[model samples]
Target chain A: MTPASSAKAPFQNKLLPLMLLLPQLLITLVFFYWPSVQAVQQSLYIEDPFGLSSEFAGLANFTALFKDARYVDAFLRSLFFSAAVAGISLSLSLLLAVCADRVVRGATAYKTLLLLPYAIAPALAGITWMFVVHPSIGIVGRAFIAMGIEWNYLLNGNQAMGLVIFAAAWKQISYNFIFFLAGLQSIPQSLMEAAAIDGAGPAKRFRDIVFPLLSPTAFFLLVVNIVYAFFETFGVIHAVTSGGPSKSTEILVYKVYSDGVVGLDIGGSAAQSVILMVIVIALTFVQFRYVERKVHY
Target chain B: MRSFIAALSLGTVLSVSALAAPVEIQWWHAMTGANNDRVNQIVEAFNASQADYKVVATFKSTDYTELMNQTIAAYRAGTAPHITQIFEVGTATMMSAKGAVKPVFELMAEAGEKFDPKSFLPAITGYYSTADGKMLSMPFNSSTAIFYYNKDVFAKAGLDPEKAPKTWPEAFDAAKKIRASGHPCGLTTAWVTWTQMENFSAWHNIPYGTKSNGFGGFDTEFKFNNPTVIKHFETLNDLQKDGTFKYGGRTTQPEGLFVSGECAMIATSSGFLGNLMRNAKFNFATAMLPYYPDVAGAPQNSIIGGATLWVMGGKKADEYKGVAKFFTHLSKLDVQVTNHQQTGFLPVTIAAYEETKKSGFYEKNPGRETPILQLQNKAPTENSMGVRFGNLPKIRDLIMDEVEAAFAGKISVKQAMDNAVANGNEELRRFERTAKN
Candidate 1:
């Protein structure tokens, strides 16, 4: 074939792949990107959907939110919640994945048990925890009572926060573990063998070879886990404490949900959504720019 | 080939006939537990009573607010059901949907259905009607706040269960006794904003706002931070400090606590009576909510708490007729009495109340008449009538947020209430600019 025909042949080869990707691209734009843009636009307008009336409020909703101290408190609480979830889930999961990677047998069994929580729906996970920790009916509460611990979520803000945080971490560990397991298995075992032969200790082998290989995976999972912590566990929070006994467990996403869905302040809710998106986007951008680069891979 | 053609034609004819069944009126509601069983019974009775209509009831899950949101989204997409049970606070939101909703009064009038708005309890139907008494929606399970106490627990605490507290001071005494008796929870409340603030404003005959709490116009301002409210919250704060009162989160039924024997006393909607009466193994007694004895016009009246059935527009004319017929059937006295008996909602009509009384049901069930007496003890003032402000749902949220803040000791009750009032006024103004004529 001539040079021009050869170049044209490559283009022809890629045509099928491009066509195959079109449907997913369309779906993403329609379901995700389009709604995201609309949510931003909606933040700028007060809508009475029942009356079909819309008014341009020009950042008034955001202004009002800034003035509302509860919003600020919730935003700050969310930061702590997201960080804790990311720190706890990522660290525990990495350790679990590493230990399982060393196991010669029952790896699959251990993994199946560890990942079982991920299979359970987040809502169900929340309810299960609620039953286990309910002050009157929950097993944990019963145990606490028996031990003479005056443990009541309805009165103890610290205990309420601890319970919600534990529930969130419990539900998220499975997700992180699964990802970490896949990442651990994908690592080249030869590198570790080479490190071991060089008289490097287990810690040195992990530091030089295993950890470096896992960094890229860890980085990706960090972003996913943070986003999940910020948004996905609102269901759990809602089912468990409902942002109570004193709004101790109230996160930004739960506030947005209550304001939008329960309060029926669509514009206010949209403003909260916009704020949440900005936060997550900023965190994600920073991660991509800084953390991703730090990964040796 | 000849036999195959014959079979195809026969199947087509049968399918066409099967598709010709009565148009099913789908009702989506948030009733569960014993209430769910009651709803099923009602739907079965209604369906069995008529040959031309089939009323199918579907439990759409908990969270009435979420249910309303879903219904609104579905309505926008032109896929809402024929009827939906919206909580009382949603009345204004539904009313604002001019073309999206069909007034039940007009439907009943046009269909020549025998109905009188006066037949129902004024306190219940009045909330769901227009200014001139045109019924906009059908009242299904309306309830007002009542005080419930565990008699056995009260006796254990050395308080007379037969003579329940009639004022806040008395209530505090009882709560202290119960707490001193070593119970973890002495007293708790549900729907704090609704029960303690909105209904409190009415029950004490205090003005909740100017413009009759937005019934007259969209320029209504909140008066939640009034002196009575301040005093009440101060009392609650003191109780909290003393470990005698627990704010059981917004909309968390304290009735469950009473039934579980965790709490000795609870103030909750009378609608929860069915749940407690059926589930509570302990002896319980219901009483009217305690008030401040010193306040002028104290103990005026309590407002409604249950949901109403709003008829949405953009339906087939036949469907509108079907919905109207269903409303008429639902309004019958016998049906209303059955509804009241099963759900513990106050009978929406006076005739139903009379019917319920004449049948000796209230005699058999002592607490059955508490809600009626609470509603009919005094005529409602402008504030005693239910709140109808635009963005009131948002206001309720703000109030609850502040209340929770107060409970957390994050802010003084006065400061929280003041903040809520200001923030709620801003929301009201925004709503006014958008929807007000």
Candidate 2:
């Protein structure tokens, strides 16, 4: 909710901005607050999946989560997954954005091809990756096995985790690339010309001039990618690992889905979702408070 | 012209009424592919048999858990289908949900439909019955876990094509011999916990959990950490160490291994027979599940694994009547026999089974009789009845997770079973707490 106080979009009538903002505010209230309140209400009770019975046990659900080692493990695993996905996608997208920025011909084709994966659903992306890496039937999987590496992701926790991470990051990279490319293009050509006149190499120009300018976009993407990896990648995990091979790829969101939707542990699932919201809120807050200090205008 | 116009209007009115329009009974099932076709065939047969009722079947989902979730949601919303296929895992959940379902026995009785509980096979129907032996759900496509191996691979390994390994030790020894004969994997199983753990416990007459495998009460605890189950896992672990046994993830993924002939043997559901008939290019055969010979009262009857038709609670009285008629039609010996033969699901009624047997179906289709024979091998004991606990899908997943850890050598067999029991008991306790009814 940006203020209408900015002179660029100032209104003669003071209430006009509020009138325009009503629709969005109403949407936020109905969609966001309603479900959140329901989750909080549900987290307090041991409710039946079929809604047949319910028992109120204040804070018991939250306490049970703390006592469960698997929940703790899942929390740590999600933290690692979010960090890995954010870091990999941001860095790779930045590199691709730089290369694409330098392209004089077929720029639209390259950009379109790179962005194509973003349009693919997370579940489809996961399935496509599975088709390429299935140990028995996949092309790369067969090659890996032929090279004497055991390639079964089904039995190996680490391999399963790797597959999910790759699928998730692969799908996310295009969004980051689009933003980075925009940021790159927006940097004035005079700055690069000035750097070239000062005898800066291409590498030096990028490191010293380009990267600092793109820091704001990178920081924005960092938050988006972290949130995406933490919450939105459940489909990828479901399609590929399904939190299996000893729950190696079982992130917090996936656990919530499994417990709530699949396992019918309504109270536990609500408690987990509540915790997930808290974690992401705290994470975004910490990032804006500290990490944002490094971002340029 | 006026008379002609009046006659035309009458003809239109008559066609619109369509002879009192058959009552539409909605059936939601998790069947897909060939099984989906079989479901439609049954519906078509039922619709054609009578004008009073027309059963319309909807493919809810291929995954039973998702279908149950949908059914629960639909029931809560008051938009539930009249009849939903509840898999064996959801039986305890369905039983516990007092008002969520209209028990088939009660429905039949209320509708004045002739339902002889004795007509159904004891082993198949017993799992869906109450302590007083009152049938709760109508058993439709119940299947039991049985052993299967490629007889071609057996011949190649210099073993008898007709004789599948009957004992656990002999099975492992045969696997070792098959490995020595140059196959990369000798055995793999689908529905890992179902074949190796749940039914294994039942087949060996070992307790899977207390209180008759959660049949008696909600206070039951898992007893799968016993020596019989642990020893079985230990043998699997050793086999894995030597590359004789390959772990094929969870349910039905290892089916591919068996079908592709990558793994020579598999222990999975009798329901897999249809898939095997279509996909398997080799000469495959079935046998009773392997048992530990040293255990007392070993090789007891195995348990059923498919699904039953649950009459969901809250529908019109006439709708219930239609459901009753459909159930009666389904239980007819001809329909049941055709279903059993076509889909490899065990016939629910003994009459249907006897009819199939009398037709010399077994002589022509060798592996088809294995599931029925195994289920009726003996009177089901408390140990051999079947496992039934609320939130069973979660419990099974927990057990499979532990078992996978054991397969990976990350944990010992005993530790895995112990973890599974402890975790399973906690889940059971959670179920007990949340579902007071």
RMSD of every candidate to native, in Å, equals: 4.4, 4.3
Per-residue lDDT of B213-293 in model 2, one digit per residue for the tens?
998988899999998789888988889876799887788888888898988988998888888988999998888898888
lDDT for A73 (candidate 1): 89
Tell me the TM-score of candidate 2's A chain: 0.91
Per-residue error for B241 in candidate 1, Å, reads 2.4
Docking class of 1: acceptable
Across all models, the iRMS values in order are: 2.7, 1.2
Error of 1 at A157 (Å): 4.9
**Residue lDDT tens for model 1, A1-297:** 799888777666677988989999999999989989989999999888563787889999899899987789888888898888889888988898889888989888998899898887777888899889877788988899799887777657788888878888888898888888888788787877887889999999888877888887888888888899898998788888777755678889998877777667788889999888888888789788867567766
Please give each candidate's TM-score. Answer: 0.89, 0.92
What are the TM values for chain B, all candidates? Answer: 0.91, 0.94
What class would a CAPRI assessor give candidate 2's docking?
A: medium
lDDT of 1 by residue, B1-437 (tens): 99999999999999978776887888999998767898898788878887778888889868677678878888878888889888898887788777778888887887778878777777876677776778888888888998888899889999888998899899989999999999877888888888898888889998787887767777788887898999999898989775698766677555567778888888888877777877998898889989999999999998888898887788887777777788877877778778877776788888878888888998898887887899887877777878887766667766776777777777898998898898788877777776753
